[model samples]
Target: MPYRHTIGSRTYRFDDLKTLLARASPLRSGDVLAGVAAATYEERVAAQFALAEVPLRAFLNEALVPYEEDEVTRLIIDMHDATAFASVSHFTVGQLRDWLLSEAADAEALQALAPGLTPEMVAAVSKLMRNQELIGVARRCEVVTRFRNTLGLRGRLATRLQPNHPTDDPRGIAASLVDGLLYGSGDAVIGINPATDNPKAVSNLLHMLDAVREQYAIPTQTCVLCHVTTALQLIEQKTPVDLTFQSIAGTEAANASFGISLSVLQEAWEATLALNRGTVGQDVMYFETGQGSALSANAHHGLDQQTCEARAYAVARRFRPLLVNSVVGFIGPEYLYDGKQIIRAALEDHFCGKVLGLPMGVDVCYTNHAEADQDDMDTLLTLLGVAGCNFIMGIPGADDIMLNYQSTSFHDALYVRQVLGLRPAPEFEAWLQQQGIFDEHGLLPASTSSQLLKQLPPALR
Candidate 1:
């Protein structure tokens, strides 16, 4: 079913929401003031999605003048008792720029205030803020470095294969991996969350990937992205556990889903290190996260989803994961809600994680049950490509068998790189050229990749 946006017994529906977006009228100052004043938080958020950013920001600034002491003012900017900071609307674009660009800027205060605004408002604000503050905000936020420039290279983007299957069958899994690798993927990590969590099943999946990696002598890493405990179990049993996987959320309660705590993560980190797989040398954890995970687990910690996600990055940076990705909209529409929200959170998470000192990738994906589609993913991938994202999912035809959702495909990755003039991570790029899977430009068609594919074992072929 399409994700239900209804609050009560059918107060809203997919069509009604589409109508709301389609009918978004030109907004004015008084209308914004009155709407925020009278509407519930959910409705205000809906309005934020429907309204255009520049017009909404302009009118919100106008409304801020007369409604300084009102709830309406919170919509403009949640001061949150930052009393020295008067109404944000009072600051000119240049003054705001000075505050953001100046060394004395209160980054915590600025980030704290960000949750009150929509991504559109943030983007509109970005227009005035420009590169220095944008980069300053990115740095102050603590995005990890050399992520975009790993191996002393810049604009070197990356991609990974999900290689999921309905059955945890080795043959099925190998076929998917073959498809991804031949199409020029697996540069990020060939990590999989097996459909089944049985010990035998999980072990088999890991063994299969490790076998393929060794058989092909693939330089990239491999992982089974199950819960940390499962990975620990695999490691204890002497299976190949190259990376530890965990789902982290902003709040403690939400983290219960993965049964992880700071201590548990530390334990996994120590445990993985003790194995000394050293896919990247002491940086062997892979984490999956999204904006709505905290809320989905009913543990948002009283923060916005984006901020909650960033806090998860705090936990991620501790172990120094080689890959930390937000599945973006894969959790369904409840957290991200729609394409616009999904796109915004993708950019915000990438920017925030980069600042937080984590090598971050964006899974430009959405669940089939969610109110999003491939077109939305295209926009997100393009924007992330421009933003210098580290990686995106490269699944066959954008289909994830375990998660059963749509994501950027192998071809989609090629589309972005071709459009942006990006190449795969250096080692992977060299391998592709040697293998003839892709030229210096982009992925060859399957007929051409088949030239390399023919070299595989008959079963894999």
Candidate 2:
């Protein structure tokens, strides 16, 4: 239990370094690694090399826990290795998409010729790709799934109904859920991240969503995106919890910022399981992560934000979350500056999260002050549609009043389905057809569709 490790080619004495990387979930060494993020580009590159050491340790020790084998080591090296981007850089996006569409094209050919190419590498290349080209490759990829588990993300892109309000009132929250479900967005889960940590507020939100889901007979999971301990307490109170929600990070300090430890997360998972409220097998945990989380907690060790994001997924795997998303642009311009940077980061997170074996979704959002617009999100959404993203957030009118950001709207969900020939979860689609919710053309019925809205508690009306 000493604060030292003689890892590959270097000796790390916890007393000697400044990053909490040694004390985090992925590392979780007894010593708290703390340091300022590297200030210069050269310092950052060095930091990336240093960050790779722990993952390399995890990879070699076969103690990556839930992850038997992941692409973290290769991805970390690929991120720093500029040569990985060279072979694919020559062709225009149009040329690349065409080749992928052609029968002679092989995905491996890019790697075979260039060496060290990975999906994350392609995601980086996506920075230069026009939206159409990025989407084209996604549509042709076979890994996209249409219907799996309680949620359907691939065959039809799914959306979470994030109806967060300032008061956590039943009427306001109910109104948002009605808006999303009527717009065809409850395929993922009606998850809410509370503005306050009050257990009563969270309990009211969960029970309220349960009432709404039952009324419409919508076959989807529901969650209150509070801390693990809050959720555990709700479960202790015998409240219905379909999925346990938590926000996680790559480093121990970042997780500590959220007041969660690996043991706390495991306890939450076990307690939720004992309740047996999930309809989606055993994968009942819901987790949210963003690229800037580590840096925000002052825990990043000068590593690239995307690599830190992937390390968070290592925490996610421990609980087998039913839903996992990189809140993408929601972290704003600091970690990823502007729309172009945000777009590339979104794709990179999705690619890396999927490769790490987690169900991946992007928040596709931005704050008012960030240099991003709806068009940028539309582009990311289109590309994610093809990449086979698992689920996306569906806020009322693409805005979160409580969180103060612009996210995808329910109409956006309908837009992706219409443009891409996608469908919802099989059972949910069956239910939709049963209720005539969407026609063969995937269009909602005319008017505000008061039928579903009328089902809300009468006091709201």
Candidate 3:
């Protein structure tokens, strides 16, 4: 079947639901690179108009990637809760958008609607929304989860203190970890993207982070972003694994490229839960995703990148992760192209993830070679803060020497916290106050004494 819409004197026809969605999407370099974007602005608008009339139920029938061919599509289809979708099932994509933006789509309503929604539905609705609309609907959907600390609470923002080292140096990693903590940045997790994936090296990093957490009694989780299989091995070795981390994609093929499958993720989730490591909650999985991953892996199956990105969220949703973030701009300019494109994709990823009920965060970053600067990051970070994002990456100085990208820094986290009046995770915030690093008002004191110093070892001090 075909979808068509007329504006003025012209009628634009989209060959299929997938083509209609691709055409309806806002302009992005990745879509263009994949040869899926609309040929002209008018065609794009026409597709949006046609898409607006699409019934929500249509997505249930039209599998962009056939159910027989893709496990992700199967997961999406088999796991959908029709009862949860009843509220908006009869509405067109446009009507769904209207309902989401209306006053009735409160936090409670959105949560109830999450299980019923497929990732494609949310992605379709997102295409019809502007940045502000995206922000508005997302802020209303509060998806909280926990491991060592509570995250996604209203008026609270968390940071993943990425103390990445160029050579997996324990000393260098420790210095950056202490620095991030002193700057009040590790409420989400003190995560490291290690330079080496050696099982022993990764296990050592995990133990080192555990030792620091034990020594200082920090109220947070720790993750060494390595392969799921590596974490599984570490778990068998009795390593301190607070969270099992993986970079997941939206499709089975894309996930296979990362050496993961739904079964593999299920195994990791079960293995991590067996440790009973969390003091607060058992959501121990941490996932990172990005746009264009499926296309990059040659696994997109002709779907647009944004839709593929949303499908990845379905994978994350299956696990009930402690943290699920889109490293939006880290894929470099080939996908997002420039600051404007990066900003748009970040908002879209955050919005789609939140609506589908994930504890979503963003790595607000760009490559050095990309057409973006710190100012672009500042704009995105501030906007995400305003939109009530669950967490962000907190590098040392907005630069990841190891990852070679410019992400938001520890200071950047503080700036957003100060400007937006957001606080860290409650448990971590109390710990900060207890250490005298943060005062009663949650502001850093003008003067520092040996109080905080006493909490650290001599080397860190």
Please, what are the lDDT tens digits per residue for candidate 3 over residues 238-296? Answer: 99999999999988999999999999999999999999999989999999999999999
Best of the candidates, lDDT = 3
Tens-place lDDT digits, model 1, residues 13-48: 222221232122122122232231213555434433
Once superposed on the true structure, which residue ranges of model 3 sit more than 4 Å away at CA?
446-449, 455-461
> Considering summed lDDT, which 10 consecutive residues are worst modelled in model 3?
449-458
Give the Å shift of residue 151 in candidate 3: 0.7
lDDT of 1 at 268: 80
Using TM-score, give the best candidate's number: 3
Cα error, residue 247 of model 2, in Å, equals: 0.3
* Over 4 Å off, model 2: 1-149, 447-450, 458-461
lDDT of 2 at 27: 16
